[model samples]
Target: MKKSIIYSLIIFLFVLLAGCEKDEPMGYKGRPGVYFNGNEFSYSFAENPWKDIDTVLLPILLTGDLEDYDRKVKAIVVSDSTTATGDMYELLEGTIKAGEETGYVPVVVNSVEELEKSVVRVRVQIVENEYFKELDLVYPACNFTFTAQIIKPYNWSQLEYFFGPYSTGWWKFIMEKLGRTSLPYWDMWSPIPNPDESKYNMSYYEMSNIQQMIRLELADYNKHSTTGPMKHDDGEYAGKEIVVPAPW
Candidate 1:
């Protein structure tokens, strides 16, 4: 009876070991596959670009295994009639090497003309190639889309209450540099003085105050054709004549 009991215990241990081995996770055993790091990408004419053109980089990741040999990955732009084209944007194609976990596809916005007409959309997809396969099950899958919109230079109706007719060219300049419809006065101004004389020589608070005064003076000039209470009363320029400073 004792011999039989010991033999049964040994058989049970062997079965448990075999079950654990069977359940083990498979890690990096196959060829590398590609997927976008995220499901969607977006850009806005107001928020993204500082100038006429801008570039956005989308990341593609490798899965399954890191290999000793280089893997070539291909991506293409997917678009329809509703999508923006021509002067609006340019699509890019590229590759990833073996053992590289990430690669980038650069989407360049050539102009904002399409945005003026309507919101523009750009779509891209990863297709199966000789070296890499598209992963459809992933979050970004083999397909992703980007949307761009114009949100700056508030219209007359939007600014009339606070700024009246004075909120024209300068307002657009501020929006372009700050990338927002509303100004955050407190954040732009700092109580601490800047030590770097070569840069601006004034505290952030002082600089912001100067800008505010400039706006108020311009507003008063528009209303009364005369300067307001600001000590540094620079001459006012017509809304159409005002030009954006080269460097903000």
Candidate 2:
């Protein structure tokens, strides 16, 4: 009876070990430490860029209607983060289609660190559809602004830091550089010493510098999204336009 009991315990232990190993993949990284909107994101880029690494750094935004589906809209946003400067992120925005009122948005970021060099990139895209017929009205021309804010862990604190050093005369120096403004304050992100001081007072040079950086980053999107001229409706319903029934 003692021998039988020992053999049974050993079998149970072996079965438990095997069951645990079988459920897990070969090389799981476990849970990530940090999370965005409650979803954990791995900083490592296990999958390499399928094309030239530079191609991934460019900002891109694309929007177009589906050929056959009048009620569907498609949008694509892409950005590359493997550049020399340690900044990576992108955002795409445009009008949504009218029909089912369904849409999707995607955000992507890539991080790379080799020796002393580091790079981070972010990209975001939103797709949406709306049913105009349900409202018993024609599709009105509307503009929706979609914005994606890409924040690199390192540079994320720069804006605050620039404003943090208020005593060293750096603020005045920055104001001179940026052409300091007392009204509309300055950049929305710029910190203010007090709220009662409704106007923003800071270096215009610094504000301009930040603005320039933003513009340069976004310029890439316009260049990459188009491959060639697309077929657009001239006036009447051509192959591109599908007129929906008035009463449906």
Best by TM-score: 1
Q: Return the TM-score for candidate 1, rounded to 2 decimals.
A: 0.49
Per-residue lDDT for 1-248 in model 2, tens only? 99999999999999999999888653323311110111112122322222112111111112222222433222343334222232333322322233322232222332423412432323222233352222111221111111121111111123433232122133233334445321123344533222112322445475455545433433443356474222222322223412111210
Deviation in Å, model 1, residue 34 alpha carbon: 1.8
> Can you write out model 1's per-residue Cα lDDT over 34-118, one digit (the tens) per residue?
7776655555555444557866666677777666676666777665522766677776765566566666666777645556556
Give candidate 1 regions above 4 Å deviation: 1-12, 15-28, 68-70, 140-248
> What's the TM-score of each model vs. the native?
0.49, 0.21
Residue 188 lDDT, candidate 1, scale 0-100: 18
Error in Å for residue 166 of model 1 = 27
In model 2, where do residues sit more than 4 Å from their true spots?
26-75, 78-123, 126-154, 158-248
